[model samples]
Target: MERELALEFARVTEAAALASARWVGKGDKEGADDAAVTAMRVMFDTVSVDGTVVIGEGEMDEAPMLYIGERVGIGVPPEVDIAVDPLEGTNLVAKGLNGAIAVLAASPRGSLLHAPDMYMDKIAVGAECRGRVHLEAPVKENLRQVAKALDKLISEVTVVILDRPRHQQLIEEVRQAGARIKLITDGDVSPGVAAAYQDSGVDILMGIGGAPEGVITAAALKCLGGDFQARLWPEDDTEIARCHEMGITNVNKIFTMDELAKSDDVIFVATGITDSFLLKGVRYFKRRAVTQTLVMRSTSGTIRHIEAHHDLDKKPLFKDHRIKLLGE
Candidate 1:
């Protein structure tokens, strides 16, 4: 992918974030998500790549826009595969909570995993701990390695996990291991990538999240030279059958970062929808909106934190005005 494409992708996420930010604290999670999806779909039309949605809202039959296998962009050169979460945390936006984002990952054709929408067991850590931790290792063991890699005591290590009932045992194990825990109600993608930044206050990420998000996280971590490992967590025979239909014969196969992202030539972009550790939420003032975005590229190992101020009065998000910038 060309370097200029990263900025183009940033605009896509920014449009999604700006559109969704208007719905924050409105108790309308679906509305916020719809606003973001519509804005992202519209902005993608201006991009230069010929992109296919490898991971997105849903399959074509289930979603009206940005569905899996859907074609995006202007049908130009440098065909790529895309994975997007226009609104990563619908609940966070609805409650005006933190950690919501509009995130996407892109890579050369066939470079990204066509991850199915299902639960995935994941373990992520910063570059310092790369090759030091393993997903199959016990929670305590992995924590120990992270602490050792960072030259900190086990108790000083902080682990991030989604606050879900399914992680009860995993949470307990981390506590027993004497590591601090940061439990979030939704959106693991931010923390998963934050674990790669030294001062993000996140030492590691462990537990289950959406498989598609895991792939997106892998792409970001690849840019940071971090480590991410995952395995599909099929809950029942139906999920297993779905995996078979997707050509995944080994339901329990563990995926390394290389397997998930498949190439170093990947770009990951995110615009914050709500306040979080890595990026700030969209802030609106009058007819303008301010956005903070994180853009990363694996090939050059460059990470850019961008703060943009948009003149909403002059910025028409959609060609058809599908969503009002300030929810007007």
Candidate 2:
């Protein structure tokens, strides 16, 4: 994909963030997600590409827009695969917590994995520790190698993990290895990407998250030249059948970065709906709404941090004067 594609992808993320921001602290997670999905779908119609959603919110029968197998963007140049998370952390946005984002990644057709909606056990580290950390290795061993690569004591290396019951054993292993643990309530994708940047204060990301999100996070890591490994974790026979339907025969297999997102020419963009480590949250004021976004290209390994200001007084797309009359 061309460099200009990054900007186009950023536009999609911006639209999603803007729409979701309106529902912030509204105590309605589903409303925030719906707003983002609607706005993102509308924005895709204006982009110049024949894009297909290979990994998205749901399958064609499940989600109305931005769903797996759904075609996006206007027909034009650069036929590509699009993976999107219009609202990565809906709960976070509803509660006005941190690390909610609107994220997207695109590459040439057939470049991204069409991951089914299932759980995936993932382990990721920075490029420096590439080929050192392995999903099959014991947790302590992985931590030891990561610490040695960074030239830090085990106690000083901080591992970011999701705060879930499934991670209980993994968390205990990290602590046993003398590595510091930072458990987040949700949104492992941001933490997975943050692991690649030293300034992000995240050294490694370990544990299982949504399989679709694993691919999304892998795309960003591929752009950053980070190391990532994952294995599908089917919770039951239904999930196993879903995997089989997706042509995944070996459910216990591990996937490397290349296996997740094979293309080097990948573009990943994310706009923060709430503050997190990699980007700041949208800030609203009487005059304007400000948002921070990060756009990255895998080929050049360049990440651009953009802060945008939108004049809220201006007419928004799909604005209904009737809503104002109703005090909405």
lDDT of 1 by residue, 1-328 (tens): 9999999999999999988998899987777888899899889999999999999973321333477898999999899999999998888998999999999999999989888888999999999999999999988899999999999999999999999999999999999999999999999999999999899999999999889899999999999999999999988898899899888899999999999999879999999999986899999798778999999999998999999999876876643477853455
Model 1 — TM-score against the truth? Answer: 0.96
| Residue 277 in model 2: lDDT | 76
Which ranges in model 2 have alpha carbons more than 4 Å from their true place? Answer: 58-65, 318-327
TM-score of each: 0.96, 0.95
Worst 10 residues of 2 by lDDT: 318-327
For every candidate, C-alpha RMSD to the true structure in Å:
1.9, 2.4
lDDT for each residue of candidate 2 in 267-290, tens digit (9 for 90 to 100): 999999998978898887875788
Clash counts per candidate, in order, are 0, 0
RMSD (CA, Å), candidate 1 to true, equals 1.9
For candidate 2, list the clashing residue pairs, or say none. Answer: none
